[model samples]
Target: MRYLAGNPFSAVTLPATLAPEWSLQIERALAPELLRALRESLDAHCARPGDEAAQCRIARAAIGLMVDSGLRRAEAAGARRSGVKRVDGIRGQSMWTLTLVGKRSKVRTVPASPATLDALRAH
Candidate 1:
């Protein structure tokens, strides 16, 4: 008779069912210490003298874009010089932003820090 039921477990609550529901633990961003370590490592690499130093500078710039602007990997990878725009801000100050296509092909502009912009310029 029990086998007649579509699901035998449906009629009873098993001990395993009493366990607490599991929730996903997601890390949204890097910790400050980790971020600092990463920056130091990149800077160290950039300081090295060699042909690879040029590539390191570019890598640092790309990583700077990702860290400063909250850009996704693909967005930073596809970033172009033409996409960087300078606009006038309050009190005649200059503001910089990077325009890029994000997820789902959505076009958006994100603010760029001076340090990051300088890195890009150097690269």
Candidate 2:
């Protein structure tokens, strides 16, 4: 989702925008198996009590994000530990944000659900 700076004199060669950008669309519903796996993982994460809780939370959050969101496997794997953020806006309301280095090293923010953030905070 980047455009070349349009500097003709520059030597670096790159495309103005990634191809197939217009095809982006969010699906109406998640697949049944994907939903099941997500719920199971999140549940297991919550059930594991003790010092390993953070690991479970990270695992569950990662899985929930991929199935619940559009992140790819590699993208999820590359998600930095410092990138998970909660932003407060109007009336002390907060929204979870997932920041990661996307394709081509593009840093982007994704809106995460309250449930996802709650799971993340549990650990």
Candidate 3:
């Protein structure tokens, strides 16, 4: 409306009132106990040696990346072994990081837990 009104070859008027507002809904996160239970279940499934066990390992790694690193579904799915790197932290301690290509092809490095890295390696 503002652009049309500003145009010399057109006639338009902006509305006096503002647009209506809507409340945003947010979902609750799972409890820590529930997460622990889920990890235990996945671990149990992973212990069996078979094709299904292999799949369970992959699922466990993906879930660890998503939960611990806050990675999106697509980002977690796209993660690669080459992306995992060990870097020196401020305290001179070596730490693990995962490089991810997120939305819009933006690259980012996120800290990865040792357990998560182990899970990834197992897969």
Per-residue lDDT tens digits for candidate 3, residues 6-77, read 657456665454332232122455678998999999999999988999999989999998777667789888
| Residue pairs with backbone overlap in model 1 | none
Better of 1 and 3 by TM-score: 1
Candidate 2 runs further than 4 Å off = 1-25, 32-37, 41-58, 90-92
Please write out the lDDT profile of model 1 over residues 1-123, one tens digit for every residue: 566759657779645322222232235667889888988888888899998889888888988888777887898988888999998999999989888776666676777989899888889
Task: Please state the error at residue 18 of candidate 2 in Å.
Answer: 13
TM-score, structure 1 vs. true: 0.72
Against the reference, the lDDT scores of all candidates come to 0.79, 0.70, 0.80
TM-scores, all candidates, are 0.72, 0.56, 0.71
Which pairs clash in model 2?
Answer: none
Give the count of colliding residue pairs in each prediction. 0, 0, 0
Model 3 spans > 4 angstroms off = 1-28
